[model samples]
Target: MSPVSPLLELDGAVQADGLDAGVAAHYGNPMIEQRRLLAGEAVVDLSNRGVLGVAGPDRLTWLNSISSQELRSLAPGQSAETLLLDPNGRIEYAMDVIDDGVETWLILEAGELPGLHTWLDKMRFTLRVQVVDHSLAYAVIGTMAVDPAAVHLAPAAPNGVALTWRDPWSSVGNGGFQYADAPAHPAADWHWTEALVLRDRLPALRDAVRAGTVSAAGTLALEALRIAAWRPRRATEVDEKTLPHELDWLRSAVHLNKGCYRGQETVAKVHNLGHPPRRLVLLHLDGSDAVLPVHGDEVEATKQLADGETERRGVGVITSSARHHELGPIALAVIKRTVPADITLHVQSQGISVAAAQEVIVPQSAGSVAEIPRLPRLGIRTPGH
Candidate 1:
């Protein structure tokens, strides 16, 4: 667990639970906070998020050789996201990366730092790269405002360039692919950014909130907006079987044409010839009951049978759900790729069944973009023979 954030001491602050336990969930009015957050007048206390720094001259090149992004040419102050995958191509870590000439900063979930730090250290070998945990020294502040100055925070600029990481989810990154066929992707408007500030600055930021110079939102408001935007978070959307293609993560965090990395073969094969077994979707849940399905809640759908009967079948599980201030109750779920896009699903939440409508993110035909032609086997015998 991370050290409790000092912002929790603010009046009307309610600490969040689960993954965001150490931070404030809301400062009394989540709906108003969400409005402030969307209007670029609020900042979120993300002290629970982890920060890692990679120093030395070889940081960029070394990182490019091991992760899924093309980071060799990452200019100073440019923001990018990368993924570390296992041998089988399952996601192990998702990092928001930014270089500041002196060091490469990696912002990720607090729980992921220790393991990612250990693995990075072992990979250094003879390279001129050194990884250091900066989570305790620097805390993350999240805001929808693209400019850090809008939030009244001067982002750290140890190397003369600010350390804010602008999310690339707003558009398909170079060498990346988009599986969502929406004419207007929700992510196109996502201007989420994270700014690193010295941990000591928290008190001053809290004071600013008290003085009304700035407003403060919480992780819940951010999560609600993230869900509405169809953003896939590493901590919630990822499972042992998750593929970048499933959540349409290839749109931002992956470079499909990049050189070999740990799971490049599987990544290529899946994109070229196979489909991810599952796909991610945004669920518009029925809000009449006022019940919200928690994570891991079963999602089922009713199917009409040939015998004129109806049957309910399990189709997926809700990974993340929230009560959006505008969108009502919304959720992101991972469902079977074969599930019909027009189907009305049911979320079993707190003993009541809530109806959900699916908005396709990763379609059933998400992969096999290459459409490579199959050839006949040379050793096959002719039917007459």
Candidate 2:
């Protein structure tokens, strides 16, 4: 009989079937399949991101007044999405704001710390909110080992629907309900912890994933899964030039009835009356083998001409793309309304062809404000003049 293998052996049982070969090459991670499967079956660690703690007497109210979400309505232990927008209503950051009651925590992209913290500090004022950086205190997310006991776990109280226990792998940085402000519990005693993981411990988790004690995943697979889930990412989908409404942020972030905030008027106008200059659309590539186009790739929609003229100049652009075993090559693009959905667009750099599909496709009538009309050119020129 063979000696017992270490439970967290570095090279163990790995279900490597989910990752398609072409997808793996494009993503540089052949281990994505294991990660996806593990996400469904266990808990996965993703504590690399940063966490910010906001607490005080007026914390929720203060946050509600400043951000793009209805912070006041968030129940104790519930997590919600919020956006920090520039004065012109462009998205600066998109974050998950979780209310642990005593302190509402902000889980943000790792790269967003400097700008986000600065912005929050600038906004700090007469309000009693205190913002603390908790990135190094507690491990934000850790190895997801499937707990048989967690299966059939009932929804926790107070947070109600907001607190569903999944495998925990799927809920990475996803807010968990904390029973804060309960009749028996006071908000003062609560202190949220965010951990900075040591680089050395990563191997143990990876080994667990490989040995079937846990599952291993790479960034590529995680992103592909996120796309399938239709969760918008900050740096990718929501960025400097992006308006909150155009990214479907209103569904999770903005409150239609909330009082004034810095960019509220523009947000409201865009949501109520104006049509965004562009609409967000999903692209499903026909060829699975094609490398998913890189971000910022131009999408050219060619119109067939009777006179054999060349295809018209591109009217769309690709924002992001990822390889999904289930969906093959997929992307999110912003295109001019004139570009019809039936038209096949070539991803300019790779020459890969893809057709646009509606994930949450909304037309002009879908409550988005139409683009504000441009004023006539002051120095309009004519060839004759």
Candidate 3:
């Protein structure tokens, strides 16, 4: 047998539906659920996420040598993330990494499992590392804060406590930097967290929800909070050409000073000398209720050329969008860095157009770590000549 499919297993009161093979979109009302979640009073079943186990003495060191983060010193239960990149620095996979003293657990999107696992296996070679898919045996749960009510629902963390990856998206983590310049970045209020749970414990968790003894939220609530906080998700934010800079993900995901791994050269070059070609923006979508742009929707804007004729052109594309319980409709889009900051954007979803206001995340002046003085051209005038 392949494995027992996990879809539609917890639908009694929660009405768990297919967000993925083994996850629910919403328990009941996503708005109420989101409120309960932000208040640290709810849990979200994340069983559909892929969990991979790495064991052996060389696990952390081996992983550090291959991916984007500096993970050799990762302590048990400490959370971190790393990206696997192609030779040209395009993102290939993103790993949400946590370690117990004896093993390392990598959490990732479900659809990425086969590729990630196969690559991990091929890379082992003579190393003492072993990789296994533990998705069938484990699940992931998320909440907004670190409270016992949330903690106890999941299996003990890799360090012999409840296993939780406290999201570092709220601030600049070690060896990383932030380019976004809002005086009070809304992410300052972000406290979202995820934990690993044993698959066996899910039934009890669902039972508690059914009995009204515990509150549970869903992915809808999770996504709304994520966009509002300007956080990045691999499933939505990354494309074949995505670099950390475009999404402002360097705040937590990339370790600038970490020794070379795949893609480090490009990361260093772009971040230090060149501006990323595109920038991420948060859009406060118009409340016309005509349309809500989904992922991949084109963001259009009208621009006037020197001739004074207007052209409606695509300046960006929506990656993720949601209707927040409080914020109404909102989205995160990646726009050309050259797109004028002052112009209003329109999201084209079918025939309806929703007006959007850009809230810049990555500023236009987002590069040049160290200035290199320009050398005077040969035979050209120098200063004071």
- Candidates' RMSD to native: 2.3, 11.7, 2.7
Model 3: worst 10 consecutive residues (lDDT sum): 1-10
lDDT of 1 by residue, 61-156 (tens): 999999999999999999999999999889999999999988999999988889999999999999998899888888999998867787788787
Residue-by-residue lDDT tens digits, candidate 3, 1-385: 1133242355532433433444567755889988988888888777778889999999999999889889999998788988888777778898888888888998898889999999999999999999999888788888876664643475655457456777778788899889999999988888877778778777777777767777777778888998999998888989888988898888888899988898888889998899999999999999886588988999998988899899889987999988899889999999999988778999889888889999999988887776889997779778999
**Cα lDDT computed for each candidate against the true fold:** 0.92, 0.55, 0.83
lDDT for predicted candidate 3 compared with the true structure: 0.83
Better of 1 and 3 by lDDT: 1
lDDT, residue 271, candidate 2:
69
Worst 10 residues of 1 by lDDT: 146-155
Residue-pair clashes, model 2: 12
Runs in model 1 deviating more than 4 A are 305-307, 374-385
Residue 42: error of model 2 in Å? 3.9
